[model samples]
Target: MTAAEPNRGLIHFSPRSGWMNDPNGLLHYRGTYHFYFQHAPGSLVWDTMHWGHATSPDLVRWTEQPIALDPAIHPGDLWSGGGVVDLRNTSGLKSGDHDPIVVFSGTQGVRMFYSLDGGFTFTPYDGGRVIAQPSGRESRDPKVVWHEPTGQWAMVVWSDADGNGVDFFVSPDLLQWERTSRYAAGWFFECPDFTPMDLDGETVWVLRDARGSYVVGAFDGRTFTTAWTSPQTITTNPGAAGSDYYAAQSFDNVDRTVTMAWQGGNHGATWTGNASFPVEQELVGTPDGPRVLSRPVDEIRTLRHDTQSWPEATFSAGTHVLGEGCTAELEIAGASRACTLRIRGCFDVPVAPDETLRLLVDRGQLAVFSGLDYRCLNVDLDRRAAGDEIALVTDGPLRVSSLVLHQLRP
Candidate 1:
């Protein structure tokens, strides 16, 4: 991999070719995990979107699959939405040997489709029927979750009503949906995610938007209510050209909370975008309330090769070298000053000796994380090489509780 063709990532999931963005319909079906995305196979730019597919046994290693949804055959641009595996056959769309997988997408309204052959192909429901029409304004990006207590499935769809809000629709069989309630707020926008998680041994729901802004709340199968007062951000804003982590979604049919987002910084001659490293989500108690926190999936340990560790380290204002390899994982605990991470010029974060920081670097991908912030970035080789700059830099003094670095393998 070089500057001419896009650098194939060592950890991040990149398109084999063409353009892609926004991980859609994340689901664990059968034995493998499926990652569907908004894809345009014809060019290196965003066009009419189709659902591109990839599968992985573990979250770390992925294999690109054939195109799952084509605009010419799937109708419309396919847009973006969520997917689920109907193990109970609630949709009654199952046939042959495999269980049915239900997916949703559309604009100004929501549409349903089912896959009977284990997600290799999808058939439109009721000939592409709009299950629920728009009420106050436009609607799109439907994310569905099953409520075992209520024995129903609920969809969280982005809506333009009341300035910005999400409409909750309940369905029994995934074939029919009834608008039950709407949660309106200024932070609600595209790619809304509604999920239930365990917080302090209590089950609570988390409502999040595309930009990683989220609020902790409670849901009763249909309606959602929260006392957050205002939304808190789980990630930094994706306004810079190099920092691009957006539209993250968790996988359905999985027992644990795991998520992946679109890293929107990669732009090369061959392909355009890639998926962020998968992260496990958890709810930690804060002074204000329960807040969402994310960390890289533990499965990433499979890629570690040559490794080194230090119990603790301190540094003065100077440059620290990190060897010749560009792809590796750097773990730092209890930082004291801002550190500029040199890897395609993607990682540059401040540490306060109050949190744990982990930085993952690959061919053209970079992800930085702590308890408070999560971010990912992509780059092309033409712009900057990974080893061209120093690995760590501090302006003043710094102290770390612990530090480790590992040489990652492709």
Candidate 2:
């Protein structure tokens, strides 16, 4: 299939004109996936933020839509938040029988916007009135989810009284809300999401941390109690260990629950760009606990140009070259001392004599070094070996396979 095929590999959606960040207002309504984000049409800065909208039937192919929420519509700028479909049409009835309600956060307060003629055009409800705002605290990044058990709506807002964290509120009707509790201090928790996941026939709440990492816990609508001692780090591209990945969130559509992140330069950096790709997230069991593993979605099979496989090969302290768009595998043995096998280079860095053999890959350079404590080889030269193996993508060109020199200990 061609690159522009409908079912192409991991696809990405950014503003057609400018800077985009933080996937916001993710909703699946009327058999379509709709999402919005913080977009600045002119510059790369975050000052002038607007809601950029896009829709997709399948998660792989996205169709861009017009600006959903403009800053000019409201007095102040648009901020990060989420959207939900009002299946019941609780707001009011329109000519089409029902409308989609979008709850978003802005500079002044949390406001609701609705679309009568489908999700194409949206206007503020109740004369664009502000619903809720803290007295002394500034609240933004509102993530709303409907609680099925209590039959109530819950929202988590990014606020600061002691420090930057999330505050919880409950609403019987979407309009009026009551403050219930607060999730104590942490780093700037921008996009907080609470969803129920099935694990071993038990339900667990997944909380997404925008700035740092995501947490899996048990939540009872009013309060969230963390079940895990530590939070899991969410990265954009699990295939490569680059520093340009950050700020990912989950999109729970009808078909699947996938996650996406902003793939670009780091914050306060000048070299930021766009995403390499978007992958599907799956929950798998590990020895430690349940972890998230990202892989190119099944649609990616259409993007395969050609497939090449290397059966069995052994190399020792030598340099080899290969053409582009190729996959190669190597198995080494009989090295008494830890040694390095450099690909596309001639230098063989010494691996510690006692450590296990290591595999490293730079941009296009690939190598294998020995030793567990090979600090230089593991840290500086081979940056891919820093994280857990299951979380890493092994099918791509950046995959590194390692082998120990000695025989099995059994």
lDDT of 2 by residue, 302-368 (tens): 4344333322333433333322211122233333444444332323444333333433222222223
Q: Tell me the TM-score of model 1.
A: 0.91
lDDT of each: 0.81, 0.53
lDDT of 1 at 184: 87
Give the local distance difference test score of model 1: 0.81
TM-score per candidate: 0.91, 0.69
Candidate 1 runs further than 4 Å off: 1-8, 238-243, 313-317, 334-351, 379-382, 386-390, 394-400
**RMSD to truth, every model:** 2.7, 9.4
Task: Please write out the lDDT profile of model 1 over residues 1-410, one tens digit for every residue.
Answer: 23335456767788778888888999997789999999998888878899999999988888889999887777654888999999999988778899999899888888888899988789888888788765666778899999988999999988888789888999899988898898888867788988889998988899988887888888999799998788887676554222477888999999889999888777667778888889998999878777778888988898898787766788788766655466788888767666655554444555555467888877777678876677666656434563443266777787777878888776
Model 2 ranges with Cα > 4 A deviation: 1-11, 93-101, 134-136, 227-230, 236-243, 266-276, 285-287, 311-410
Which 10 successive residues of model 1 have the least lDDT summed?
381-390
